[model samples]
Target: MSEPSRIAALVVAAGRGARAGAGDPKQYRLVGGESVLGRVLALLGAHEAIDRILVVTHPDDGDFYARTTTALAPAAREKLLAPVQGAATRQGSVAAGLARLADGAAPEIVLVHDAARPFLTPDLVSRAIAAAQAHGAAIPGISVVDTIKRVDETGRVVETPPRATLRAVQTPQAFRFAPLAEAHRTAVAAGRDDFTDDGALMEWAGHPVVVFAGEAGNVKLTHPQDFAATGGPETRMITRLATGFDVHAFTVGDHVWLGGVRIPHTRGVLAHSDGDVVLHALTDALLGALAEGDIGTHFPPSDPQWKSASSDRFLAFAAERVRARGGIIDLLDATILAEAPKVGPHREAMREAIARAADIPVSRVSIKATTTEKLGFTGRGEGIAAQAAATIRLPEEDA
Candidate 1:
C-alpha cells in the first residue's frame, strides 16, 4: 500500500461582505457568542482527515485574524499555516492560498471552504473527503425543493427549469490538489475570472465533478437578518461548573497580583508568572469546565517564555476556548486566602480586572477574601491561596 494521501483545507475569508452590513466583515461577526470564522475553524481543525489548514484573509484584517485565533485551542492553532493576503476577487484569494500551500510539500487533496459557513459537521467533511479521493473533484449540494424560474432583465419569464434537477451547492468543496491548482492557473491565464466557485472553475476546465449530499444546517451567514434568525450571540446553552485552587508561598517582591490587579503587599508570591493566584485559579477553573487541560498543560513553568508572563493571557485564552466551543462564561467566583494587604479595598477593582481578562461583564465576576482563622500556611502569612469556581454555558450538543 502507498502512503496515506495528505489532505488540507483552505478557508477563504478575505471578502469584505459589505452586503451583510456594518461593523466588521460577516466572517468576523459573532454568531452564538463566537466569531463565524472561529466556529468554522474549530470544526475544520477538529476534523481527523485534514492534515493542514490555511486561511486567506484581507490585507487590512491582520489584527482581526490575530484576535480570532485567540478562540482556538493551542493544539488547533498549531495546524494553521501562516495566513496569506488575499486579492480583490474570490478566485484570486483562493489562488493566493493555493500558492501558500504549494510553497510547502503540496498535499494530495484540498478542501476549499467558506469561512461564513460555521455549521459544517464531521459527517459532511468525511463525505467530501471520501468523494474527492474517489472522484477527481466533488462538491456538496442540496437538492432544490422549490419551483425553479428563469427570467430576463425585463422580468419576462424565459424558462422554468425542473426543480428535481437543481441542487444548491455548499462548500468544503473537495478536489485533487494538482488539478484544482492547474484549473486556477488556467483561468488566470485565460483572463476568465467570472467563475464564482472553485467547482465551477473546474467544470470550465473540463474536469469531471461529482456532487455529494449537502447539509441544510450548513448555511452561510449572508445578511443582518441571518444573524438575528440564528439567535445572534445568545443561543440555548448547557451550563457547567468547575472549581480550581492554587497556593503560592510569599517571596521577595513588595507587591502581589490577584485577579490581574496589583495589590501592594509586604511580600510577593513565588511563581513563574506574575503570581496572580486569583487569575491562575480562575483560568484553571475555566479550562477545567472545557476539559481542555490545566494551566500548567497550556503554559508550563519550565518554559522560559511563560516565566513572569501576565496571568491575564492565561485567563483570556481559557475564555476564548469556551467561546470556540460555542460556550460562554456565565459566572466566576474566586476567594483569596491571605492575611495581608486587605482585599476589601481592592475587591471591585479585582472583579473588574478579571472581567476584562475573561471578556465578561464585571457583574458576572465575584471576588472575595477571607482568613483561615490562623490555621494553614495562608493564615500564618507565609503564602497566599486562591480558590475559584466557574460556571460556563455551552451548546447542549457539545455536552
Candidate 2:
C-alpha cells in the first residue's frame, strides 16, 4: 500500500506588527501568560493530524524566537523545523516557508497559519484539513454579522453588499501541496506578489477554493487594545475568587522556602514537599477557585511521587488546570505571617518566582509580610503561616 499522505503546518510570523505598538512583534508578546507564537505552536503540535511544523521569522528575530519558544513542551519543540528568514512582504515570507518545505520531503497537504491567531483550536484544524482533502483547497470563514459597504476613492459608499452572503476569512487556510507550490512559483515568476492571501493567489492561478466554518473565538491579536479585549484576565466576563491558608512548623534547618524563593533562616519547615507556605496557600487558592480539591488532595504525602517535590510544581499544575478549563488567573495576593527571615528583603523576587511558576505577569501577583506582634507561633518564630486569595475568570456556560 502507498504511504499515507502527510500533512504539515506553515506559520508565517515575520510581520513587524507595528500597529500593535511597542515592544516585540505582537507574535512574541505574552497573551494569557504565554507568547502568541508559542501558543499557536503548542496548539498545532498538540493536533494529531499535523505531521510537521515550520516557522518563518524575520532575520533579526532569531534571539527573540529562541527566548519565546523556551516555554514550549518538549514534544512541541520536537515537531518544529529550524525557522527560516523571511522577506519584506508577508507574501514573500510565506513563499520562503514553502520553498523550505519543498526542499525536504514535501507534505501532501499544507495548512498556512498566522502566528497572531493564538486561539486556533484542534477542532478548527481538523475541519480545515478535512475540507482541503475533499475539495483540494479550503479556507475557514465566519458569516459577517454587520453590513459591509464598498467605497470609492472619494469615500462615497458605492454599494452595500448582502450581509447574509458575506463572510470574514481567517487563516490556517489548507491546500494541496503540489498545486499551491506551483501557484506560488508562478506568482513570483510573474512579479505578482501583491496578492493579499494564498487563497487569492490560488484563485488567480485558476484553482477552486472552498470555505469552511471558522471559530469566532480564534481572534488575531492586532492593535494593543486587542490583547485586553479578547477574554484576557483584565476583561473576562466571568470572575471567581477563593482564599487559602497554610502553616509549616519550624525544624532544625538553616533556610526556608517561601513562594518558590529560598530565604536564609535559623530554622526550616518539616514537610513532604519543599514546604513553601506561600506557594502552598496560593495553590490551594487556585484549586478552590476551580472548585477542585486542595494541594494535598492532588499530591498526597502518601504518594512517593510528591516526596520532597518543589512547591512551585504544585502551583504550576494548578495554573495549568485553570487554563485547561478556559480560564485566566486574574490576580493573586498573599500575606506571609513570619517574624524571622524578613520577607521585605525578597518581596519582588518572591512575586517574580510565583508569577513565573503560575505563568502570569508579576503585576498580577502581590506578596506582603506581617509579624503578628510576637503573640502567636509565627511571632515566636516557631513556624511560618501564609494566606492567599486568587481571582480567576472562566467562560460562562449556558445552563
Candidate 3:
C-alpha cells in the first residue's frame, strides 16, 4: 500500500482591500506583531498534511510581503509563483495560483483561503480537507445569525428572506483538484468573473457543495474595526522538519561518495551505483516530502539505467522536482554512521557537496557523523549508513 500525496494550501493575498482604507493592503496591515496574511499563511503552513503551498500576490508587492511577513522567509520568498498584477477580482488571483500548482501536476485537493482571514484554526483546516476529500467540494459556512430582509431599489422591504436557509461563508474552502479547476475554466469561458470565492464558482457549476459549520471568529479583515478585532490564539508559526536514512553494505571499492564528495575509504559500501549513502538519504528525505514515493520508486536498483550513476544526480533531480512544483529546499541536516571512515575530517567538504547538490547555501547544509559502538552492520565495519533531515520552504500558498 502507498500513502496518498498531501493537499496543497493556496492563500490569496493579491486583493486591494479598497474598503479597509488602510495605508497598506488589509492583509499586510499589522495585526498583533504579524500581518493578516502572515497569520493566515503560518496557520496553514503548520499543518502536517499540507504538501506544497503557493501564495498569489501582486507582482510588485511580492518583495514587500517578504519584508513584512515571516511566514514567507527568504528561502520561501524565492519559491513564490505570483503572477504580477493579479486579476481585478479574487477569482483572478485564484486562477494564477491554480496555474502555478498545475505546473507539474495539480494537487489532489486544493484548499483555497483568504489572506485577509488570519484566525482560521487547524481544526477548521482539517475539517475542510476532510469534507473536500469526501464531498469533492466543501466550504465553511455559518448559519445567518442576524435578521434578514429583502429590499427593492425604492428602499422598501419587498420580502423578508428566511435566515434559516442563509449562511455566511468563510475562506479556506477545500475542493477536489480537477473539479475546482474545471469550475474556474468554465466560469472564465462564460465571461462570469464576479465570484468572490472558489466555492461560489463551484456552486455555480452545479457541483454539490457541502457546507460545514464555521466560526464567527474566523472573520476576514475588511474594515478598520474588523482589523482591530482579532481572534484565535497568538503566535501561530510555521516550521518544517525532515528526516532521512541510508544504508550501504561493505564492498571492495577504494573510495566512497559521502554527501556528494568522494571520501577516501579502505572498503567502500556495496550498491548499484557509487554507493553514496549520504546523498541517497538526502534524496529519500526530499521524496518523503508530500509522501511522494521513495528513491527506490524513482531509481530502482534492479534497473540497468542507474548502474554506476552518481548519487548527486538523484539529489539534483529531487530539488528540481520540488522547484518545478513551486517549492525550494531551505536547510538540511545529515548524519553518517560508520566504524572506520571518519566523517569529522570531511564534514566541511560534505557540507559543500550537499549544498551544491541541493542548490542551496553551504550555511544551510549540515553534515555530522557518529558510530554505534560496533553494534549493527555499519557498527561492525561491514557497511556505512547515512541519514538526513531536510527543511524545505515552499510558497505560502498553493492551489
Candidate 4:
C-alpha cells in the first residue's frame, strides 16, 4: 500500500481571549480540569493523520503553556514540536507558523485551527484531511440556520440575504501546503493582515476553496457564558505513587550533604557524586513513579562528568522528566536516618532546598528524621540512609 500523505496541524493559541474574560487567556483557562488549549492540542496530536503538531503561542504565555501541557498523554506529547512565539494579529500568527514550516521539512497538508474550539473530534479531523487532499483547499462549515442580513451603518433593515447562500464557517481549515504558504507569503508582503481567515486569504489569491461538513457541537467558545455551559470535558487522569530507599557510608570529612543542603558533620559520605542520600532517594522515587529507571540509570557512576556532581541536579532533572511526560509531581516525602548530625536544626532549610530543586511549593515536601537506636549502620554512626516517596498524576491512558 502507498504511504498516506504527511500532515501537520498548526494551532493558533496566541489570542488573549479577551471576550471570554474569566481570567488569563481563554486558551489557558480550565474547561474541564484541563486547559482549553491543552484539550485542543491533545485531540489533534492524538490523530493518526497528524504527523506533526505546531503551536503558535504568545511570548508571555510560555509558563502557562508549560503548566497546561502537563495534562496531555504521552502519545500526544511525542508529536508536539517546540512552540514558536506568535505575532500580534491572528493573520500574523498564521504567517509566522507558515514561515516556520517553510524553513524546515514542510508537510503535504496543513490544518489551521482555533484553540478556543476544544470539542474537535477525530472524525472531523479525518474528514478535513481527506477534503484537503481532494479539493486542494477546504474549510469545514455548517449551513446558517437563521436568516442573514447585509446591514448599513444605521439600525434600519438593509437587505435579507438567502440563508441557503450563507454558511457559518468553522476551523481545522485544511489546505495544500505549498499553495497556502505562497498565498500567506504574498499577503504578508502586501502588509494585509485584514483577512480574518485563511479561506479569505486563499480566495484573495485566486485559489478555489471548497467547503466540507462542519459540526454544530464544535462551537467557538467566545463569551463567559459559553464557558459556564462547559462544565468540563471527560479527560481521564490517574495518580501514581512510588517509593525509594538509598544508603551511603560515611568517610573522613568535615560535613555531609542531606536533602539539598550542606550540614556540618563529623564525617563525609562515600559515592561517585556529592552523595546526598535524601536527594538520591527522592530522585529515585520520582523516576519510579513514572516507571523510569533510577538515578544511577540516568547519571551513571561510570560517567566521568558526574563525578562529585551535586545531587540537587539529579532531583531537578528527574522533576523535569516528569513534566515532559505530561505528569504532575503531587508530593515528595523523605525520611532521613542519621545518628551524628541532629536533623532538627535544619529541617526547614532542607525542605526549602528540596522544594526549590523540584520547582514545587515547600508545603509539598516533607522531611522527617529518625535514628535506628544504635542497631544498624545508621545508628552505629557508620553511615547515613534515607527513604523517599513520590506521588504524581498522569493521563490515565498513559498510566
Q: After superposition, how far is residue 260 of candidate 1 from its true place, in Å?
A: 25
Of candidates 3 and 1, the better by TM-score: 1
* Of 2 and 4, the candidate ranking higher by TM-score: 2
Kindly report which residue pairs in candidate 4 clash with one another: 32-232
Q: After superposing candidate 1, which stretches have Cα over 4 Å from the reference?
A: 1-5, 233-326, 329-388, 391-399
Q: lDDT of each prediction vs. the true structure?
A: 0.88, 0.88, 0.78, 0.87
Q: Compared with the true structure, what per-residue lDDT tens digits does model 2 show for residues 1-399?
A: 545439999999999999988788889887665678988997887688887899999988888899766556545666788998888888899999999988868889999999999999999999999999999999999998888999999999999999988889999999999999999999999999898788889999999999899999888899989987864434424689999999989999999998899999888899888999999999999999999999989999999988889999999999999988877788999999988889988999999899878877577899998999998888887889999999987766400
Model 2 per-residue lDDT at 297? 91
TM-scores of all models? Answer: 0.66, 0.64, 0.57, 0.60
Q: Given candidate 3, what's the lDDT at residue 290?
A: 35
Give the lDDT ranking, best first: 1, 2, 4, 3
Candidate 3 per-residue lDDT, tens place, 1-399, comes to: 444445888888888888987487777876654567766665665576786678888866866676654344333334344433466788888987887777776689999988888889989999999999999999999998798888999989988888999999997999998888888889999999999888889989999899998888888888767764552223232334567788888878788888888878787777998889889998988877635788999999999999999999999888777655545566778888888788888888888777767766567788888899989887778888888887774433421
- lDDT, candidate 2, at 334: 100
Candidate 2: lDDT of 347?
95
Q: If both were scored by lDDT, which would come out higher, candidate 1 or candidate 4?
A: 1
Candidates sorted by TM-score, best first: 1, 2, 4, 3
Least accurate 10 contiguous residues by lDDT in model 2: 229-238
Better of 2 and 3 by TM-score: 2
